[model samples]
Target: MSQLRSMYPPIEPYSAGTLDVGEGYRVYYERVGTPGAKPAVFLHGGPGGGLSPEHRRLFDPNRYDVMLFDQRGCGQSTPYAGLEANTTWHLVSDIERLRALAGVDKWLVFGGSWGSTLALAYAETHPDRVSELVLRGVYTVTKAELQWYYQFGVSEIFPEKWEKFQAPIPLSERGDMIAAYRSRLTGDDRATQLEAAKAWAIWEGETITLLPNPAFSTSFGDDQFALAFARLENHYFVHDCWLEDGQLLRNAHRLRGIPGAIVHGRYDMPCPARYAYALHRAWPDAAFHLVEGAGHAWSEPGILDQLVRATDRFATAP
Candidate 1:
């Protein structure tokens, strides 16, 4: 564990369980903090990613009852990336069902990146069910954002990593990296899928973590991290995240009265700070905290501290 992890109070692992969402799908999650305390649910990023133990440290275990669940087709969830019935809408519905199963009428929604996007979507659909929101690394599935990620933004700065990311596909397919990676990742050729997964992981790892040029860890190999990642990326990118362009902000009216906070890194290369600023401008009532000298990494000292503080405030505030 990092020294930073030790600074926070120990988070005791609570119940590990699964919620059946029908169609042979099961969502797995773990609870931390006091069970009877105010409910605060965490939405992990990555349409195919799962929650990590360190993610639970964002909240003060003594003051809040924290719930972290892997979204459908990710983490401990069954039929990983099966996509038989998985969709953004299905995710929002799964949340509603989870709340009912957990017996919480309302809870704070905490998410970052893709998680933040889902949080906004859910709050828009069911504002009454959300008591508040604390979002980090906001990602609004806009075409501009997608284009930037796939072609212009990160690649502009990290050309070396970009080169590796594009090595698997020919120059002709480079223009449509998402499609190329999806076709290879979903194809019967395991070696090709693994190679694509490596590239994808390398690109993501280089950007999301603070460590410089971090090497890909094989520990997640058995976890099927690559397949799950490619599947979900294809699922979202293919459909533009199932949004009709600017749908999130256009529906911002639903969250007009909700108490919310946005924490973003000014130097973040993954999602960029511009998106956060735009969201803050749209929802002036929501507090926005931009951390200087921080990138997209959650492990950055300043960024992590701010994130935990935000959650602490939301968990304790009346």
Candidate 2:
């Protein structure tokens, strides 16, 4: 029941640059807050969801060296919506590359939704590189988890929104929404891609919040943003995040000694609370808080409050 601390004042980054991570990919990153402070990297959600200025405010400007970056094909990255060479592994490597370029030995990691998935993957791969973790709206991206949200589970609750999400596809393709959307999202035609992108983005926007977010604008406003978000999300989901069945969960053993925190909404439609619970169970040593009266959106007051507090706690930890 802790409340969210007021976010640090809006501050510009002390440094910003692009790191060429090969494979025709360049990541856009910015270092904000104290120049010589505890380094903390912010992992954005959406395999394609890029970084925003608001992301930098979660930390204490005087205490944390906050780093925010756009994953491949995202935000200010060189190729807008370019899916080539983008995968879960590529992102993990990009993080290490960014870390090396930043000259940090180890730093805190913060992420939610798909960010949480990538955070877990990265931490497991290089446990020595992570000082601590703070994850919100956790998602392991299992096949069944994908089906539950897209196939049928969430639709039961938000049938109307699901209908809009389903309308773009034909009855024949209804059996597999991800495949149907993927065809158009990554298709050759620009117009077709944008339309499908909006449909895909709107469905997620409408469903992510427990209560409708009047302030929530469809992320598809920027054609590039929309296209990349849908295309990348579908791309990752179709390939099952390029992970083996239950890979993240099975590999949870690697997170044994890492200090961590999990903050989840009781009614997250995109990634249900059960997934978070399961992750907490696996990483039994980590702290878990279930925020009631909230949904998947990190903007939700309760969810944001807990998330901010988690980061604050880790900020002060030895």
Candidate 3:
């Protein structure tokens, strides 16, 4: 496995604020590094995964002014686990709102997993506002992608994990795991909801890497974190991420002039390498690297190494 590049030293945001995006939603955003440095926005995974301190370390604080935020109902954002008025479109717009609020005209868009999906959605919507893209564990939330993860694909590899993931739902509902989980995650009983949330969160947590990562497993216990993570994930999956089928790839033309790098794990079970391959086929200008000995986790050594190198290359780009 290739070793990951050394991450930038951990640092807190120099400025932070919550922008009310209307309909009772407020997104928590922060800016780190030299304020006047080249601007970059980090889009987090899970649609509900939100941001972490470690996420901010992906970019050099001196070379790039980094923006990180808890989108809609995740992380520090209000209405924890909220699903109302939350859609892929809402998040794309939220990104724009934060950009204007930060006074940045254009920026490098860095994202992984669902973040990659949102990055594509946002770039396709306003390609003029994106300077570049650095994506990892590429996922475009296509119907096939969702079916592969939640319905059929991943089960073939992680039967054990799939069994546990499906334990919460009946066999009949197994065909529609997202709907089944959505029922429990949005159910009235707190106990039932929390139990389903933990299952939903842990199943993905345990499977996200090539090997077991105990540290990642621990986050499944945070009630608020799991609740939002599971609820929002299930909600998005159930809705097919609120895009026309094959939207990201269909709209690849919009990214014709944009420079991009796609880094994906060869062994990514949740989001197989095929989606990244399909995207590369569509956007041939975007560089694509298939990292060996890795899975979907950004923490994977090979995947991380490639991602950091891609970012560094962008830092020096004209």
Best by lDDT: 3
Better of 1 and 2 by TM-score: 2
Better candidate number, 1 or 2, judged by lDDT: 2
**What TM-score would each prediction reach against the true structure?**
0.93, 0.97, 0.97
lDDT of 3 by residue, 42-70 (tens): 99999799898989888888888888999
lDDT of 2 by residue, 214-273 (tens): 545445445777788888899999999999988998899999898999999999999978
Residue 280 deviation, candidate 1, in Å?
Answer: 0.2
**What TM value does model 1 have?**
0.93
lDDT assessment of candidate 1: 0.81
Reference-based lDDT, each prediction:
0.81, 0.88, 0.89
Q: Which ten residues in a row have the lowest lDDT in candidate 1?
A: 214-223
Model 2 lDDT-worst window of ten: 214-223
Candidate 1 lDDT by residue in tens digits, 53-115: 878888888888878899888888988768778888898999999888778889999888889
| lDDT (Cα) of model 3 | 0.89
Rank the models by lDDT, top first: 3, 2, 1
For model 2, the superposed segments whose C-alpha errors exceed 4 Å read 1-3
